[model samples]
Each structure stands twice: as C-alpha cells, then as structure tokens.
Target chain A: MTINSVPSSKVRVRIGHLYGDLLNLYADRGNILVLTRRCEWRNIAVEVVSIGVGDRIGSGEFDILFMGGGQDGDQQFLEDDLFRVKADGLRGAVHDGVPVLAVCGSYQLLGHYYDPGTGPRLAGLGIFDMHTVHPGLSVRRCIGDVVVDWIGAPVGGPSSVVGFENHGGRTYIGSGARAFGRVVSGNGNNGEDGTEGVVQANAIGTYLHGSLLPKNPHLADHLIGMALARQTGSAKLEPLDDHLEWQAHQTILDRRASHVAPVGGRVKGSGGSAR
Target chain B: MRSRRLRTGFAVAMGQIAGWVSRAVGRGGGTALPGLVVDYLDPSALAHLARQLPGGVVMVTGTNGKTTTSHLIRAMLEAAGWAPIHNASGSNLSRGVLATLLRHASFTGALRVPENAIGVFETDEAAVPRVLRDTRARVLVVTNLFRDQLDRYGEVNAIAQQWRDAISALPGSHDLRLVLNADDPTVSALDGGSATTIRFGIGDPDVGRDAPDHASDANFCPVCGGRMRYIRVTYGHLGDFVCDNGHARPTPAIVATDIQADGWEGTAFTLKTPRGERRVSLPVPGLYNVYNALAGVASSEALGCDLEPIASAIGTFRGAFGRFERFTIDGRRLVMVLAKNPVGMNEALRTVVGRGGSGHHVLVALNDFDADGRDVSWIWDADFEILVGQVSCLTISGHRADDLAVRLKYAGVIGSIPSSGTVTVLGGLADALDGAVSGAPVGGTVVAMVTYTAMLELRSLLVRRGHARAYWDDAGVNSPEVTAR
Candidate 1:
C-alpha cells in the first residue's frame, strides 16, 4: 500500500469509537480513519476494528491507540472501562514501549480525570500528567495550515510539520512533560498560543483531524518504523513502498496547500515523481 | 384593519412590482447565486413594515428536529382554532419569513389578519436572537442544542450561552416561557431567569444511558460545574437529568413517556405531563420526531392552545419538507430523510433502521463545501455505523463524494459509487429518489441525506418535477401521495 516505496507489513488498529457513539464521539473517529487510511496508502495493511459500546481492545493488539473528543458521558462510560481494560496497562505497553496516539478524549484519558471536583471525576489511563476540565467551551477550532517543530525523532530530518488543530481541552505541560509546539497559527497550550499540535516520544497526540498522517507523512513513517522496530529489533520497516500512499497523502497535501500555502508558499515537486 | 387593508392595496402593488422585477431579473431563476441574492435582500423591509399591524412573533430554534417541532407548534395553534400565521415551508430564514408576510400582507403594507392570532415561525439557530429583537415574541421556546455547522456557528456551548443572554434580555412580563430540552445541560442552563421554564424530554429511564450518543452535547451542567446526570437520552445530550448546583436538570413537568416505535417507521408515545398523559402517534420516524412533537406540544401549550388539538395535529403531522417526507418523483416512490450533520445523519440512519430493512437503495449526498462543514471530518462521526450492511447498495454523491465514499468505506461498506461528477450528484439525488420507488427485489424505500444549503437545490429540483410541494399549502389534500408513506 506504500505509494512511494516498497510495501510495509500489515498492522491492525482498532478504533474504540462506540463510546463516541454514546458519549458523543465524532472528532476522535475522524482521526482514526484519516490515520488508518494514511497508513494503508503507504501500502501498510491496516485492519481497523471500530470498537463501539461494549467493545474491548487488547494491548499489543493495536499498533497505535487512538481516541477522539466526546461529551463527558463518553468519558463517563469509559471511567471504569479504561480501568478494567487497564488503559494505563495499555499505555504501559506503549511505554514498554508501544507507540500510542491519543487525541482529545483519548489524550485527556491518558492521564488524570475530568470535571475534577464537582462532576464525576473519572479516571484516565494515566499515561501522561494531563488533566482536563469539562463544561469548557468548544472555542478552540484551528482552521487552515498547522506547522510544528519536532525536537526529538527516531529518524530525523527537518523539525517542521503541518496539520489541523481542533479541541477545547488544553494540557498545562506538567512535570517531565513539555508543550508539543507553540501555536503556529491557531490556539495551543492555554490554547491562546495558536499552538498547532503535540508530541511526546512515539505517542504523538494532536487535536488535528486531517488524518494527521496525510498531512505529515514523515510522522506516519516514523511511527510505522517505530512499531516495526519494536516487532523486528530494527528501527526501519524495510521494503517500504509508499508510492500509492504518498499520492493519497497528496490528497490532503494538495488540499491543504490550496488553503494554508506551505512554508515558502509552495513546494515545487514533480506531480508524479518523488522529490 | 379590514378598512386599512383596502387602503393599503396601492402599496401592495409596489411590493408586487418589486417581486415581479426580481423574478424578471432572474433572482428566482433557481440559480445558486439567485437564492443567495434573494436571501441577502433585507427581509426586515417586510417584517418592519408589518410590525404595527399584526400579533407579535413566536420564534423557535434548536439543532435537532426544530422543523418538525415548529410545524407541530403551528398546527397545535391552528387546531386550537386560531389563525396562526406561520412559515410551514421549513424555511427559517428572513427571506422565507418575508415571503410569508408578503403573501399575507396588502399594498399599503397593512396586514389583513385580525389581532387575535399568534405568529408561529421557526427561525434558524443563529438567527433566533436577532429575529427575536425585531419582533416582541411573548413566549420564546429554546429547544435543546447540539453541535451544528462548526464553521459558521462556533461552539455549541457558545450558542447556548448566547441563547441564555438573549432570554435574559427579553421584555419582563411577556410570559417568556423557555421550553428547554431536558437532556441537554447546555440548553437547560438558559432556562434560568425566564418567566416560565418548562422542561420536556423522553421520560422513560430505560431509554437513556449513563453516557450519551456519540454526538451528545452538554455533558455537564454549565453552571455549578456538577455532573449532569441523565435518566434517558432521546438523542445526543438530550434527556432527563439535573445538576447538583440547583442548575436546571430534566424538568419532569412536561414529559414524553412510552416513547415506542411502531414498526420504527414512526413513533407512538404517551405525552405525559402535569396536564395529563395522552397517547400520541407521530408519523415521522426516529426518537427525534418524538422530541419534535414534545417541543411542539410544549410551545402550543404556552400559547394557550388546547391539548387535544396539539395532539391531533401532531398525530396528523405528515412531516416537514425533507425532514422525513415521502414522495413519488418520476413515477418512483421514495422517502427523503435530510441528514444534515453528524448528529442529524445518525438520527436519520436510526429512523431508516427502524423502518426495518433498507430493503431499498440509500442515496446520501454529502455537500462538504462552506454550507456543509468545510471539515468533512464530521461525516466519520455520522452513525452510518448503525447501517453497515443493513441497507445495501448505497449510492453516494455531493460536493464531497470522495469524502462520503471514504466515510462509507471507513464504516466498512464497500464499493460506494462516488457520483462521477457534480451534475451527477444532482442526478444521483433524483436517481436514488427514483431508485427508491423503482421496486424490484427491494420495496419502495429510498433515503437521501442532504445538507442545509443543498436542500434548497434539492427542493427546487423536486418542486420542478412536481415530486415535492411547499408543505404549507401542500398538506391536508392536494398531496395525499406525499403522506402515503
């Protein structure tokens, strides 16, 4: 499925979205499709099992863990489910180290609880030191292009990246934690910074839902490499053909370029050829 | 007034002259721009000129099921034997409102109606507060709110807060009754400081959940910050529940109980309230229509309409334009379920599911341009998850056919035919509508989900073919084929 390179191994990503169905989960599921298909386009086989209400996911069972924004009831339903499923245990598996990407609700659930004192103080997987507040406004909606600088990467190149940022929850960047990037255009931390996206180790979480990978293929490659690296004792997922996926990624790239003109306005690359 | 109307005939000639000029200038030629042009024209010109000659206005707005709710409210008042002036066409804009008034007004700008009637109109979500300012509506009804058109209407919470502010500014003693959706915490919060705060919802606890639907709104009470609990959810964050901070929870006064689906084609329910529990039937399918009916009953009650007429009119309710209207386009019978947003599409799909088998083709036109969310990301949120293989052979089109096709694929349905081109999308709507009635192995069941702006395009097309008619004058007789569903 890789568009510009050799085919990579298949991976199954189960999108636990049913909670969204009940707890108002729309944004999360959108990220899953965008990410899963973006991975598939790189010729990476992604078997997506959208687990709704009463559905369960196993650790190492998923190459990447994902969640979306939902109403407090969404978190309400998962209060115990995350504990029973050991969201922490799953994240522990990620730290041991499986790459986990939780966004909005998933990100919020990765650590601490919401509606802290008054509302139901449900537990998250505690993967991060993050705590969120409910009854907050859906004020943070990042339109147009998103650019971020990556400080650390298993496979390094440029520090810059682009995507969409949309969410109401914000992380204060607690002890041992750090702000992913200063807002390039729209809101970030405290959400007034125009912060675009976030990343901590292999677990890259963002409020962006342009199928993050489609807009940032390098990260997709990095995560794929990291996942494969864990499974094969090698960092790179060899024999990768990303031709079709690169083209698919181009779908958003072409789309976004029209909206958020790239760094220098445009990157001149042959329509069908690789840079 | 009758004498004034006779004298106003001269001015009516002038307004008609304008209308005729616009028609001649192609403003009504059915172009995309023409509709926009008509809308851009100040509807206030008509509303302002008629303000002194008529009864005050009644404005209704919310995300889910507002059209059906507005229609039911209008009917209840009419049945109560009042000449309720209303826009039954489901057009909640200033243009539609002006057109409605123009149709009833005379030349010198005098309203022909007597003063004993009520003006029942459904205003758009963002347009309500502004429209309210223009007309002194004694009773302002606020149905529950959910996320809609994220691009245009910022946040659901923001809108709910705006509603609260708007209600607070209303004239002190006009009986500003707020009909709050019990399930939504964000909406109920606006109930404070109102002359009358009556809460209505699906009363059966068995129907609700501790959590909410994938697209529920207002999880916690906006005030007090306490966890807003739900006894049941009709859909989204709408249900019966209260907060610890004395914030408004689901008020049990006006309740909808025994909300059961009759073959899921539509709903039959017990309208339980302090007045009495009445068994009501809604021909419109989905749990949403149940809410729509309840909201209608509550508003009609506020206007002092008799309960029986409200119930009867709701029972006889055929449904708003494509909200769930059944029609025969080109000798083919079909049902048009307007699935506008993620929450809407989910409910629409749920209704289609209740109808039992898709047993018919489903045509979904997802317009993801500005009118539709520029971020088609919400389509993934649509409960298309409900109708995986149930309704086989889904034909997809619209501005973003690729996105919808991709969405259907993500939902695990394969081979979604992306309408080859833009014209094909329009063609697809007709083809799918026609396919519903084609009747082969599958029965006459074609469901189409279109966006708000697309509905204008869709309605005009349906009207030209005579498959659809304006719901106001179209109901009761001339369109039995429409209600045959």
Candidate 2:
C-alpha cells in the first residue's frame, strides 16, 4: 500500500544516458518512462531527466537514479567518467535510500568490481555487495516471462514473470550480500535458478529490459512509490490510470499468445535482445 | 543418385497435421524446434542421415549477398535441370539446416534423397568451418565479407581472417572447389594457391555504384594487412579491388558487364566469363543485385550447372522474398526491400531514392539485435543522406526507434526520424505499418526497407491482413532468371 503524505508533489526522474553509452536494452528506458508516467498519473510531478557527465548529483536532490546496458566498448569508454562522478557521496546517497534502478552495465558498476574484465577491470563504488564477472560470452539470452520477488520497500513482496534478459555479466554476490530475486529461467545472479534481480535498501538492479516498466508497470509503480516514499518519508501514493501501459502489456501477451505452448501455455525463448 | 530429403507427402501431410495441432493446442513457436531437435539428436545419427544421398553437399557463405546470390544459384541449378536439396527457407544455421535435412531423410534411414539433387546450403559465415567439416561440401561459394554483428562476431577483419584460416585448414585431400568474389579483397584471399578457386565480379564502371554506400564492411586487404585499393565500389565496401600487396588481387574468371539499372524499373547485367559473356536482365532493381546475380550464375557454373539456362532463368527471375517484393497496402502499390546491414539498406534506399520516389512514402524498420548486429553505429554509415523532405511521408519502426531517429536527425535528413521529427516511434508492429501506410495518399507507393527480423514480422503482419501472400507461393518452384536489360 502506497501511503501518501499530505504535502505530496510530483517527482521527476531523469536517466542520464550519454546517448548510446548504455541504454542498449530496449526494456531499460521503458522502466524509467513507465516509472515517471505512473507517478504522474498518481498526481505526482515526476520529472525524468536524461542526465549526462556534466549533470549535477547531490544528496536529497532527486528521488531515483537509473543506468542501463551497453556493449563492452561503451562500458570501457564511460569507465573513467562513471568512476569519477558516480562514486562515494553519490553511492552513499543511493545507499542511504535513494531508489536507484541499475540494469546490465550499470548494474555491474553498482557492484564491488566487474571481473573477467571487459577491457580494464572495472571497479565499482561498492554500492552493492556483488561482483559481476564476464563468463567469456555464453549466450545467456533470457526470453519469455521474468518473475521478480520484490525485496525493496512498498513492493516488498514476490512478483513473477516480468520480461526478458540478455547479458554476459555473471553477477556473483559477495560473501555477505544476498540475491535480489529469483530467476525462473536466467542467470540473474551467478547462474542460480529463478534469477530475477537484487535489491539492497532502496536500490534495485536487474537485466530485464525494454523499459521493463511499461510492460510490467506494476514493478514501475512499485519502484516509483518506493522512490517517492523515500523522498517524502511516506509510502503512500495517490491513484493513477494506465490504459496505455496496459495496452503495451497486452501486446506482449498477444505476441506470446501467437507462440503458445501445449504443456504450459507459455511462449519460452523468444525475445529480440541478442546482446 | 541422390535420395529425397522430404519424403513424399511429408510437407503437405505434416502441414495439415501441424495446422491441426496448432488449432488444437493453441499455437507454438516457428523457430524453436530447430535448436531443440539438433540438441536432442545424436551427432552420428544426424551425420548418417545427412549423407544418405550421393549428391553430397555444397555450401555458400559471406556477410552480404548470401541470401540473394545463393537463391539465384539454386534456381539456376534447377533451371539447368538439376535436383538440388537446399534450405531455401533462408534459415542458414546448423540447427535450421539440420531440421531442413530432417524433412528429407527416409523412414528406413536409407535416405530417399534426390539422386540428381545436390545439397546446396548457405551456411553462416562464422559457422562455415563447422558446417564444412561436417558436410565436406564439394563446392563453396565465398561471397564478400564486411563489418557486421560487432557485439557477437567482433571485427570484420577478424571474421575475414577466421574465414581464410578455416578454409585453408581444410584437408588437402578433399576437392575443395571455391567461388570467390574478386571485387571483395577480403574474400578473394580465400583463393590461396592451395584451393581450386574461381573468382566472379563486375567490370562495368558506368553503371557501378557511384561511391561507398557507407556500410561497406570490408575496406582492406586481409592477406598483407594493407589498405585495399578499389577500381570501383558497387555498394558499401563491395567492389572491384586489389590490395597494394601482391598477395590479394581480383581475378577475371567471372565479371558482370553491360550493366543497366533503371532505378525502380529493374536492373540487368551481363555475366562475362571465361566461356563467354551472356547478358541477363533481372527484375531486381540495383547494380548491387547485378553482382548478386552474376555471382549466383558463376557459382552455379562452378558446380557444373549449365550457364545458358542459369542465365536465362535469372533474366526472368522475380524479386527475392523481400529484396523487392511488391504488394498493395491500403490500395497503394508498395515495394518491400529487406535491408538488414547498412550496405544492403543503402543500396535499397538508393534504388528508390534515385527513382525520384522521394515524393512517394517510405517505411523503414531498423532492429539492432544479435541477428541484426548489436552495434547499430553502422547506421551513421548508411547513406540516409539521400532521404529528405522530398519524401512525402516516412515512418521508421523497430527496436531502437529513438536511436535510429537520432542517427537520421544527425544525418540532417528532412524526413521522418521515427522520434520527434515528423516521426512516430510506434509501440506496435501493426500500428507502425498502419501509420506508415495511412500517411501516404491513396495510390501512392510505399517502399519499406526493413531489417531481417523486422522483415519477418512485417511479412507475417501483411500476410495475416490478406494484403500479401507467402513469397514461396509467388515465386513458384524456380523464380525466372534476371537477364541484363
């Protein structure tokens, strides 16, 4: 239940994509837009921004942070910039409960270090107790439904079959760290079964893409509600209508419906993300 | 004698059964079984089933021109009166091809394969050595190489080198026949003295593509690692070429001559070879297609198919599935062109844009995937500079609409970028097509240059809408030869 405070305002979220750096996952931006749009419907002014290198990042200045996937070269080029900008204070801000949604490369960056090294070994800001290692290019393509057991606040519960995943980074949790969620059919965390994603405090990261928000807006609403809750110290959010998002979700259902199976009535292994 | 790959009444019979099953059990995936069947079947059992015929195997490969060129060669073989077992469905992978072979093997395991039928396969560029080692194809058609699938295949140069090493490493005992595209310096290197090689290309400088179409992948010599020199570039990086080093140079065993490309009217070229020059006019409308047809004819001849019928058949041949498939959408005659890579897209765009069809509507579907190559930076290289306000209406769709729109905006193209610039980054396939078609005035032609997966989606959508027919049903058993106009 989203508990809204009396003095609630529209929260805007911006995805600072260096345009073509990461954000390769089609589902990544959808997550952000869906998040903002859902918040707007909730009578909250959620302004999502496309921040870049020079953008400002101060504590208590924003509600949520998002970064998406990219190729190895993209990750390499942004290494120095991300290392300098997204470190320490910002990591701490995110750690102290500024809801951040990291997907793929960005998810790797949130870890202690990204190993098997894409180019140079990428060291994270130690925001999350995880180290992502490249398993030398295995086709870790995940299609069909992605179910996430939400570990964060507001939506602190189990959610099943969200979307798809295609990544090479084997996110192995460190000694003390725990998994974000379960993956029904993907190597979400170190090739474990039911690998959905991970959540530490207010931060949630996963490989599910295409702005996973619009198709699976429940997750988006959950994330936004959480972010707004963090910003206002209130878990309550006003109601909103989402026919367009429902239509988008219906599109996925229609596509899967065309390729339904006999045993489970599911369409498995059919997605366009070939990373 | 070769044995039949598809048993009699297998496809037709199985088609009914599958249809019934789909109706009964709802529906199922079209491509999932290829990999599943291959993974489940024993390798020896599969290999044994593959060789149940005397025709053996012949594989064709390259980055671009593989589909059109191989299809041409297959038709020519059949026209020259040869039974050829092929994966004409254009599923060019081990699993896909394996499933194709499964349809033909016999119940007794004694393959009733086509006696005169020769197994003509278009293998994936990276998967060639594996397919070759397995089938030991007697003849291999090596088309040009280019930069593609950077996320998976890596650099173009790396793939070319891998191709050379793979071909060269093959056992000398096998009569490894090779058909090389001399215009492409990277592929011509496969003609190393060890293998029996036959080079095919074009010589008509007048009708050749004015310059690089921007998406040319292979722009260097693979042998000496030196910059390659080009006498003429037909499209992208493909053209008549020679390396500064003596190691790689164009051979004149086969050449496309007397070329004539009438914008959208059609393209026709003469295949000039050691035997003689025979002009064939193809319905395909681009000089790039002339090279494809010539390569197909040349490859067919290398496999002992007569050049006369092959040439004649190509002259009358219609368009491939989507290279130039035409149909009526919203009462307008629209021509569809499949454009996956930058080179392919540029050539298709040039064909239409040159015809002053900018006044006409154009729809583009760009998908950046492992299938379409993750590194879509190549869009910067595509000659979309030609697309402009002259185009009355333009619609762009696919996975990365914003990315593609950004590329177009950067190109200063005055047409729709599918984002903000007079474009609609449609959320659905049907909506995109409807948006594109609806924007064009009645009777206005809509030309769509779509990527591979997009092509399939668009085709399926169009077919479902009753606006188009399955391509195989249109082309018939053997599409006519495209003769030089």
Candidate 3:
C-alpha cells in the first residue's frame, strides 16, 4: 500500500486510535495528541479516527495505530471484542509494517496471555513474543519514575526517555522478541531483568506511560517517522523547537540523579515531602 | 487490661511530647506525627479515644471533594450546636484522624471534648477500610469516586471492591448510615452493605454533557458485569446509567434541581428531600460543589439534623482551605482552587471559566510531589481545552511546569503568540502567581488552579505577603462566626 508523494503540499495522515473510550486509563490520549500536534506543527495534515468495539479496521486505512492502558475491569470486558473482532486486522497491520505504539495494559495484551494470579488466564493477540504474570495480590506493583535508554534509537535522536511506570504484572520477553530498552532507573518489566518493554518489527510495547510521548519527543518523532515512511518512503522529519519538551524530560532524569534513590513506596498521606 | 490502659497512657504522653517537638522544630503543625507515634506505641489508642466521643463519629471518603464536603459537614454539625473535632489541615489518613482525636484527648489517653462533642473526619480512599475498622463511624459518606493516584490506590475497581468489603463487614449492631452518590455508578453500587443507605444525586438533566468525558472509569456495570450506557452525564462518569443486566441508577432520597450558577459568586439550587424541599446556596462554585453540598446535607440529615438548619448552615459555610479560597492583593482578586486529579481539575477549569468570563487570567501550578500523585499525565486527560478561547493570559508553574506547558500547548490554550494573548512558564510558584496576577487588568480576576502541595506553597506565599492566614491558625471550617468572605 504505497501513497503518492505530493511535493510542496500538505500531506494528510490518519491515525487510528483503537478503543479510545475503554482503553485510556493513564492519560494515554496524550500520546495521540503528541502525534497529531507534531504532524500539524510540521504542516502534515492529521486526522484521528477512534475505532471502538464492534468496529472494523480496513487494510491500509491507518498510517499509525495506538492502543492505551485501561482499568482491569474495562480491559476484561473488551477482551472478547479485541480478540474476536480486531485481532486478525491488528496482526495484519503489524505484518504490513504499520507503526503501532501500545502502552501498559495494551502492551500486556499484545503478548500471548496475561495471568492475573487470581482470575482465569486472559488470552492476548500474541503480536509480541512475551507473556505477563501478576504474581499475586501480596506482591507489590512496580511503580515509580522510570528511565530507559531506548535500544532502537534513530540517528541523532534521543537515546533516553523518562516516564512513570505503574503495573502489578511482571512481563517476560522470549527469544522471538527484542527488548525495547535497558532500564536506567526504577522497576522495569519484571524489575529483575532490567528490561522495560518489547519491540517487534515496527510495533513497540511499553509500560512507561506518563502519556510516554509528550515529554519524550524523540520516541514520538521516531514513531511518526516510521508512520510517514509507509506513505512517503522517506523517514526524514524536520525538527521543531523542542525546548520545553526536552526540559520536561530532563527534569525527571535530573530529579532521579539527585535523589539518593528513586522516590517510591506507598507514601502515606501525611508523610513524604511534596517535592 | 490494666497494663493495656497504662500502655495507652504512656503512648499518649509520649505522642504529645513528640507533637510538641515536631511543632517546635518548624515541622508540620503537629497534625499527623503525633498520631503516628500513638499508633506505633498502642494500636488501639484510636479506637479507645473514638469511643469516648458522646456524639459518635462521621467519616467522609472519596477521590475528590473529600476535604470540602467534610468541612461542610463539620460546619453543619457545628451550626447544630455540637462541638465537632475535625481534621481541618486536610491530613485525611487514619493517623490524621487519630491526631485530631489526640488533640482533644487528655494526657491519660482519654477524650477531653465536651459532652456534646462529635467526630467528623475525612479519610483517604485507600485507607477507608482501616479507618472504618478503627472508628466504626456511625455515618460513612461516600463521595463520588474517581480514579485518583493509581500508583497508591491501584485501580478504581479494586478500591471499590475494598470499600464494598469494608462496608459489608460492618457488624449489624453498629447501624452505620451509608450516604451514597446515586449519580456515580461505582458509589451507588456500594449499597450491598447492611448500613442504612441514603442516596443523593443531581436531577437536572440539562446540566449533563452530550457525551461522556474521557476520564470516565465506570463503563461496566458494577453489579452484573454488563456494559452500561449513560442517558445523561454531568461530568466525568457521574451520570444516569443503566446496564444490560437491568441494573439502573437508584432513586435518590436527596436530589438537587433547578441549578443556577453565578460564576465564582457561587451556585444556588433547590434541594429536594423526603422531609421537604429547601433552597440552598453554596459559596463554593461548580456542579461538583453542588454534589458536595448534597453529600453534606444527606450526611447531616442521617445524623438527625433538620433540612432547614443544614441548608442554612451550608449557605453560611465558607470555602475550605485553598479550595475556592479568595484573596485580594493590590487591586486584583486571586481565587485559588485545588485540582489534584483530572475530574477535579476539569471542574476547577470550568468554574474559573464560568466566573471570569471570556478574557480570564489563569494560573495552573502542577507538582509531581508524593502528595500530588507523582504522575503528571492526568493533565492531558483533563479538559483544559475548555480554556482555549476563554483565556487571555495563562501561567504555569511548579515542579512540572514544562509538562503543563506541553499539555496546554497541545490543548490549544498556548496558541500562536498573537492570538491567544500570552503564555508564561515559570518554575517557581511565587513568580508564577505574580505573573498571572499582574497579567490581568485592574479589577480583573486571576484564578489559580493548583495541586495539593503547590496549593500549600502558594498559600504560604500569600500568608507571607499578609494576604491570607496560615491554614492551621485560620478557623475556616470549624468556627460558626466565619461566614463566606
């Protein structure tokens, strides 16, 4: 599916947001805003279409795809629709190299299955060669500010991205999948392997979602470049002034570096300094 | 048993000493540390002291509006001539409740409040079960539950289950009165408990949004696990909904209707109750405050207070500390609203826009402090786009100043330099406050929307400038003499 390049004109791009209603728990819509705004700032016309349950995904209809995390109950309710209706289409798009970004719950759902320790095993779309386990109710969730040195860094692009991670499930990636990045701080993936997410082809899955993209413009641009490549056959993107974005990203990293250790734990209401 | 009493006495004495030292050292105002000390020494100290209150205890818990609603309830109780001990500093955990009790307790670990004294405490959402276990509150007001601090409280569903379990586990003899929000499906479903449940909701369908907010969490029915559809949505997930499994919104015993909002001046509504209808006006702005007032009225009535007195007391109640708190400096007005989560921030922006008309000067201070829920991503989920065409000057500050800048920029609030007026990004709270206030024209209003800790910092700055009083010294919610300023 090739798109003809029109020189010196606005190139309209369509972004497909899967389950925009149900699967947006952790401010995940910000990632979509980042993509659209970056495209708009560069004069690349953008339109976002929300494809919810009982909807069909036509081939080559989207330049990029996004799915976000959701509460467990909401995720459970949508599993049937996700697998029965959209699984084959989603797999087809990934096979076709349509760039996709899945964060947190959606990342877990891209794997083989998720065993929540108590409920019945939930099947995933098996797009990524990994599986997640909740361990149990007694185990603490991996939550705190997280930093990752992205393994698939583009030339002259940001190599490190910072975001927040909050999840109970421990994900283990198999040989079929490549580690998305090396965890520089806080708990990542299983909190034991020092791995953060999984990367397979043009698709990426991660738990780092302080919306994960606005502050990390490099990752946003990388995904945007890949998405645009499907149409223009060129991954070159003109840079915008990212002064505020980089400052925000660096602030989290600087805070982590200054602290003796990462600020974590169930900080009681009355205790703990605000900063 | 005698040794246990002696241990409690020793704990009280030591805890008081610790509190004195904490206050003397310029720490907190001895709000929660003493309770922590008492809890460490004797776990049963809270239960023992709570039982001594002749008027029993009332606990209010929710994701948002806990402090404001709790304050309103405390003021209503005070107006009813009951000496109420409340956690006025907004320290809402079990320790904070224990500290409030400890303040009115004797050195021998006995309550020293008057014979008509009552306990009115706000509790953190996750700490509800533990707080319920200790206090066995005669009345538990469950305000609307929204997703708050996922890093701390986990998921909303998990917290809802925890609350259901806690309420169901209450013994039949305690006779706990459950004040549930009928518009909130998650809260309305919390009626499985044996407590006498009184539900309150908004009845004006005109106020509901045509579409559900992106921050809504209760899409699935809390009862039969079926998908739910909303007929009307006020804000966020609070609305009239029915599930595929026939579960529907409960008929509220108390409902608000014919709402009239006068910008920041406040909202006046007709409150409908079984006893009779009363016209109530709240100094706090927004529909969220209406929900808060409904909760306060329901809880007060459950405690045997009459509707007329409750309505009147609510009208006389001033805003909570840093919640719609107004201050006059130079020649401009600075109204502060605390917005720590998406739903709360959405309401805050709505109130600010509603009050200041079209060309409003707004300041948003965001902090990733532990108390402020370290993740700042929720700002994107909030509907700051409402201020897109309504704002003339926008100022952002605090720990995540640039983060908020990015969010507002995307929301189109920080538009092209010439069209949207001006945008200021500062790292310091005081500088941002000055920038926002000065940016407004003379006689114009500047609304400050801040997080928990940032609000604290801003309030302290105001105090230093002799514009406001320290929260601890201000008799805001407790003193009947203090009316809406």
Clashes of each: 47, 72, 1
The digit string of per-residue lDDT tens for model 1 on A211-249 reads 454335566566666666676676554334344334434
TM-score of model 3 vs. true structure? 0.95
- Scored by Cα lDDT, where does model 2 land? 0.61
What digit string (tens of lDDT, one per residue) describes model 3 on residues B1-485? 88888888889888888777876775667778989999999999998888888889999998988988998998888777777888888888888898778777777887877778888899988788888888889999999889777777777887888888888787878778899999999999888743479999999977978667888888889988888899999888998899998999988989999999988878999999988998888887889989999999899889888777788987888878899999997899999999999999998887776665587788999997788887788998999888888877888899889899989888878773346478889999988898888888888788899999999999989998999987866733223222221
Residues B1-485 of candidate 1 have per-residue lDDT tens digits of 55545434544454555555654664442212222232344334444543653556677888877777777876777677766666566656655555555555555565666655557767777767666666656666667677776545654765665666776776775455667776667766676545467667677766645656655566566776555666556576776666666665645467777777775357888887666778988887878777778787877766666677777887888777777777765444566777777778887777777666544466778765554655556676676767765655466666556556556655655533223311122225555444434532343455677776556566767777777664434522111121110
The runs of at least 3 residues in candidate 3 whose Cα sits more than 4 Å from the true structure, single-residue gaps closed, are A1-11, A118-121, A267-275, B193-195, B416-420, B475-485
Winner of 1 and 2 under TM-score: 1
Give the Å shift of residue B238 in candidate 1: 1.8
lDDT of 1: 0.58
Ranking by lDDT: 3, 2, 1
Candidate 2's residue-wise lDDT over B21-97, tens digit each? 43355232222243334334344434555565466777888877777777787677778767666666566776545
Best by lDDT: 3
* lDDT (Cα, tens digit) per residue for candidate 3, span A83-146: 8999989999999998899999889999998887777887889999999998775566677889
- Top candidate by TM-score: 3
